[model samples]
Target: MTSAPKPISAIDLFCGAGGLSLGLKQAGIEVAAGFDFDESCRFPYEANIGARFVHADIAEVTAEHLEEIWDGAETRLLAGCAPCQPFSSHRRGADTSEESNWSLLEHFGRLVNETKPEFVTMENVVRLMRMPVFEQFVQGLEELGYTVDYRTVNGPLFGLAQTRRRLILVASRQGEINVPKGLGNGPATTVRDIISGLPVLENGQSDPTDPLHRARSLSPLNLKRMRASKPGGTWRDWPEALLAACHRKPSGQSFQSFYSRMEWDRPAPTITTQAYNFGTGRFGHPDQDRSLTLREAAMLQGFPVDYQFVPTGSKPTLSKVGKLIGNAVPPAFGRAVGQTFIRALAQSIEQGEPT
Candidate 1:
């Protein structure tokens, strides 16, 4: 009988709250460590995934550091989901050259060349494909003798409850590699599927049993606006009196998704760092008269309901926690990537080739 394939080890760069690491661990890859410049990520990353968190800028991480992290493993996988803000839709009209994040992808390419890992993966906003930097990064990987494949994917199609699209790239020194096709054919996961079972709370109320279920307070005008809102409906549905001055402007007509409620049967809009704020997007609950709570936002991101965001005794601030949850790679998508990597490794082993 053929022996089972040996396990592959990985290190996650830009790991945020261990979302990618958690999915990778569940998919049978041993996550040795995670590196990020944000110190806040250390708590949740180490606590939940048990991977040592290295708090340092990616530019400061040397090949020697990765060698130590790899520690002579037969297969080394480096995963980098660099921050996508520089390439996000939100930055469409802005000048991104001055942004420090614009250089992170190139920096990631440098690390890959320095370490020469056998396997690699990266995730980013779909908009990155439109940027020249992304092209350069891909070319750099190809020039280094790595076979690379990348594609844009819809998150809901991968069993996530949110309708987010991302670009995923997988590279291998062993042979050609590609991201696995999504498993979301029958019926897409809906807003009701994930958050309907959670306890109900009033606007600005916190669940006594769960700290993350706390909601932020809304102004009276916004409260009335939410009450007037319907699932899958836009702010346009509101009465003339409740409409904001901006909405009266022609430009405001273009921003119809803001302050809208999510539909129960449909997948939610892409959760953002400000999702807890009702005005950010269509983040309002279908039944509840308030915006989505921190926990709800995390769930939509494909994080387990029990995933710890902050340690006990530490206050959960919306800005901090929201950024962590929103910036995370949906664990479901990460799981798919991890499974693809495992399959590649298995294929190489079966063919009597090194990975």
Candidate 2:
């Protein structure tokens, strides 16, 4: 009888709260370790995922360190989704010339070359395609003899409730590889699809049973504004008296997404670090007079309902927890990518080739 295929192992760099690790584990890949510079991530990442969490910057990580983490696995995989703020659409007109995170992609490329892993993957904002650093990273991979393929993907198409667009790249030393087309399952996930069943709370009220379900208290005037707002409607629909001075200006007239309530039937706008604040983006809840709670934001990001964001006795601050949720790769999308990696590896094994 033929032997079963050996399991592939991976190490995630810039792993925040272990979202990718969770999804990859669900897809049958063994995540050996996760490394990130954020110290706040240690509690949640270690609590929920099986991988060991290393609190160190990626630039300081060496191939020897990674090989030590990999232990003895022959099918080594290195995955990194470096911070993409420098290449995000939000920085379009701003001075991003000195952004500290700009060189992280280059650092990622260096590790890939040094480690010489058989399989590699990277996820970043779609705007990354426009940057010169992105070109250099791809060229570096090619020079290392990797066949790379990448494309922009919509999160909702792959079962995430948030409307996030990201660039996904896959590389293989064994042969050419491609990102799998999204499964495009049944109906698109909606805001209500994930958050409808959570316990209801008044504006600024938190469910005592779940600390992460706490919503920030809105100011009286903002409460009134939220009451007047309708699902999928913008601040433009509000009365003249409640409008901000900036909104009255021509420049602000185009910022329609601010102070807007999410429609129940459609996927939510991308969840950002400020998603818990009503004034940031279209974060207000439909029919509720407050923005999305931390738990709700995590749900929209495809994190499991029971996923731990902070340890016991540690206060669950919105800023700290929101960053973890907002920056995570949707677990569903990660699962799809993990499955694709497995297929590529299996194909190589069948042909008696190394991957």
Candidate 3:
């Protein structure tokens, strides 16, 4: 009898709050541990996922360190979404080669080159495909004998509640492997479908039962603007008297989504680090008059409702918790990647090939 495909375990780099790890575990992969520089991710990463969270700067992490933590499985994987701010479209038209965050992707490649894990996967903003670093990262894997495939994955296509697209790249040393294909079928999930049942909360109020459901307080003027705003509408919907100074400037014309409310029937705008603040993006609630709460944002990013992003007894603040939730890989998308890896591995094993 053929043995089951050797078990696969993962070490998630930059694992904020274990979003990706949770998805991998859901796909039947063991996430041995998670590594990140953010201390705040420790409790949430461990509390919810039951994996060790190593707090260390990725640039300083060596191949030996990864190997040390990458124990307990015959076949292993290295997965990460390195700091992506440097490659974001907002920074388009500028030379990003020298951005400090650029080195984080290189470090991800460096560790992969050095340790030579059997399988590897990475997720990042789609714009990264235009950068030379991405080409180099892919070339490095191919040169090391890894078969690589990558694609831009649409979030809502995969049941994530946001209108976001990320580049997912998977490399395997075992056999030919392809990134999963196709935009998902049929009527996609909507913001209301995912979060409307949440208990209503006024500005600055939190669900007493679920601390993460708290909303940030809105200013009186902003509150008025929110009340007048329509779903899927822009700042122009506001009365001229309520328009911000920037809204009058020609440059601000492009900031249409700023301080806007989400459409109940459509996927949400991309959740960002400052999503708790209404003026940051189209983050306002569909029916309420506040930006998406921590719980709402996390759920939009595909975190389970019970996922804990902070320690019990301590309330979560907007800045710290927002970064964790916004930066996470939507767990549903992560599960898709994990499922692809498993499918490829299964094909190899069924063919009497070693993985």
For candidate 3, lDDT tens digit of each residue in 1-355?
5568866889999898888899888888889989988788999999999988898887678988888887556778999998775433234355555444466788889999999988999989888888888999999999999999998988888887788888999999989988776455978889989999899999888899999999888999999999989999999999999999999999999999998999999998888888888999998898898878999998888887888887789978889899898899888877888888888787777888444
The positional error of residue 30 in candidate 3, measured at the CA in angstroms, is 0.7
Candidate 2 residue spans exceeding 4 A from truth = 85-100, 353-355
Pairs of colliding residues, candidate 3: none
- For candidate 2, lDDT tens digit of each residue in 133-217? 8889899999999999999999888988888999999999978689867875779989989999999889989898899998799
TM-score of 2: 0.94
Model 1 per-residue lDDT tens digits across residues 93-192:
5454634446778778889989889899999988888888888988988999999999999988899988998999999987868887899487999988
Candidate 1, residue 43: the lDDT equals 93
Q: What TM-score, computed on C-alpha atoms, does each candidate reach?
A: 0.95, 0.94, 0.94
For candidate 3, the lDDT comes to 0.86
RMSD of 1: 3.3
